[model samples]
Target: MQAEAQLAKSAILEVALQLAEKSSWDRIHLFDVAREMGVGLADIHRHFRNKDALAEAWFDLADAALLRLAQTPGWQQVPQKQRLQFAYSAWLDALAGHRRLTREMIGYRLQPEHVHLQVRGVLRISDTVQWIREVAMLPAAGWRREGAETVLTTIFLAVFARWLVDESPGTRKTQVLLGRLLVAADLGARLVAGLSLRSPASLRAFN
Candidate 1:
C-alpha cells in the first residue's frame, strides 16, 4: 500500500510539471494532472494539498534544471566566449521549454517565500564569472574582482531578455554580440583597475 501510494504521488507531481510547462501554472488543475496521469484526483491531493503546493514544486523543478544545465560538461571545457555562448543557448532552450510556466511564476514574486529567484540568480552569476576566469586564465584584480560577477549577471539577463523577444534566426547574431559585449566589459574592467593577466603557476611552478 505504501509503495503504490508513493508511485501515485510521484506520477501526480510529474504530470503537474508537464502541464505547467505546456500551459501556465495557473492552468494546472489537480483534475488536469490526474487525468494526464490516469490517476484519481485524490491522488494529486495526496501529494500536493493544493494548487499552490504544485506550483511551488514546479518552481523548484525549474531552478534545479537550470543549475544542472549550467554545470554540464560542455560548459566546463571551453573558452570564456564559448562558455558564455553555450550558457546562453542552454538558457534559451530552458525558456522555450518552460515559457508558459515562467509567465505564471513571474506573477508570484509578491510572495515573500519566493527566494529561489535571488538564490538561483546569484549562483548563476558566480558560475558565469568562474567560466570567464577559467577561459581568461586569470584572477580578477581590484574592484573588478568585486564587480565582475555583477557585470556578468547583468549582461546575461539583458542578453536573455532580448533573446526571449527576438525573432532572429538561431539567436546566433545576438549571441555573438552579447559575447563581444561581455568580453569587452571584462577587459575594460581589468584595464581600468590596472590589472595585468598573470600566467597559471601550476604549469611551471618548480623550476
Candidate 2:
C-alpha cells in the first residue's frame, strides 16, 4: 500500500510536469493532471493538497539530488568551501532542464494573495539550507549557526534568482557566482574563528 501510494504521487507529479511543459504551470489545472492520469480529482488530492504542494514536491526532488551528490564518496575529502559549491550545483542541475517552468512555479507561490504559501516558501528555503549544512558538515553552532544560515540563505536566493533567467552556456555564470560567494563566506568564517580564539592568558581573553 505504501509503495502504491508513493507510485501514485510520482505519477501525478510527472503527469503534471508534462502538462506544464505543454502549457504554463498556472494554466494547468488539477483537472488536467487528473485527466492525464485517468484518475479522479480525489486521487490527486490524496497525493497533493494542490498545485503549490506539487511544486514543493518538485523542489523536494532537487533537495534529494543535492544530498545524493553531497554525500558521494570523497565529498568529505573535498574542501568545505567546494562542498557547499557542490551542494548548490547539484540542486540547480536538477532544475536546469525546466529552468523557465521552475521560475514560473516560484513566481506563482510568491503572488501577493498566497501569503500562507509565501511563508511556507521561506521555511522551505531554511530547510534546504539546513540540509546543505548537514551535507557539507558545517560545524557552526549557536550564534555562529544562525549567522551562517543567514549568509547562506542570502547567497542561495541571489544565486537562484540569477539562475532563473541565466542563459550562459552550462550555467557557468551561476556556478561562478556560487563559487565566489562560497569562498567569501569561508574567508569570513575563518576570520571570525581567528578573532574568537583570543588566548585566555592574553589581556583580550575570549573563548
Candidate 3:
C-alpha cells in the first residue's frame, strides 16, 4: 500500500514538472496535474495539499537522493570541503534534466507576490545545509553551526543562479563556481574555529 501511494505521488509530481515546463509554474493548477496523470484532483490533493506542497515535495525528493549519495563509501572518505562540493555537484546533476522547469520555478518563487515561497526556499536550503553539516560531521550547534549554514546556503543559491544560465559543456562553469565557494567556506570555517577557540566567551555570547 505504501508503494502504491509513493507511485501515485511520483506520477503527480512528474506530470506537474511536465506542465511547468510547457507553461509556467504560476499557471499550473492541481487540476491540470490530475488530468495529465489521469487521476482525480482529490488524488493529487491526497498526496500534496497544494502547488507549494508539491514543489516542496520535489525538493524533498532531491534531498533524499543527496542523503543516499552522502552515505556511499566514496563520499564517506572525502575531506569536509570536498564532501560538500561532491554533494552540491550531485544535487545539480540530479536537476540537470529539469533545468528549465527548475529555473522557471525559481523565478516564480522569487516574485514579490510569492513571499511565502521565498521564505520556504530559504527554509529548504537551510534544511539541506543542516543535513550536509551532519553528514560531514561538522559542529552541530552554536553560532558556528548557524554561520556555516548561512554560508553554505549562500553558496548554493549563487551556484544555482549561475547554473541556470551556465552553458559550458559538462557544467564546468558551475563546477568552478562551486569550487571557489567551497574554498571560501573552508576559510570561513577556519576563521570561525579560531575565534571560537580564542574566545570561548564570545561564542557563548552569540549562542
Whose TM-score is greatest here? 2
The local lDDT score (0 to 100) that residue 113 gets in candidate 2 is 97
Displacement of residue 87 (Cα, Å) in model 3 is 1.2
Of the two candidates 1 and 2, the one with more favorable lDDT, higher being better, is 2
Residue pairs in clash, model 3: none
Clashes of 3: 0
The candidate 2 region of ten consecutive residues with least summed lDDT is 198-207
Q: Model 1 — TM-score against the truth? A: 0.57
Per-residue lDDT of candidate 2, residues 18-121 (tens digit): 88999898899999999877889998999899888899989999999988976588776776667778888888999887788899999898889999999999
lDDT of 3 by residue, 101-185 (tens): 7787788888999998899888788888777666655543766667777887788889988998998998899999989888777
Instruction: List the candidates' TM-scores in order.
Output: 0.57, 0.90, 0.85
For candidate 2, the clash count comes to 0
* RMSD in order of candidates: 6.5, 4.4, 4.5
Candidates sorted by TM-score, best first: 2, 3, 1
Best by lDDT: 2
Off by over 4 Å in 1: 1-14, 17-23, 40-77, 107-144, 196-207
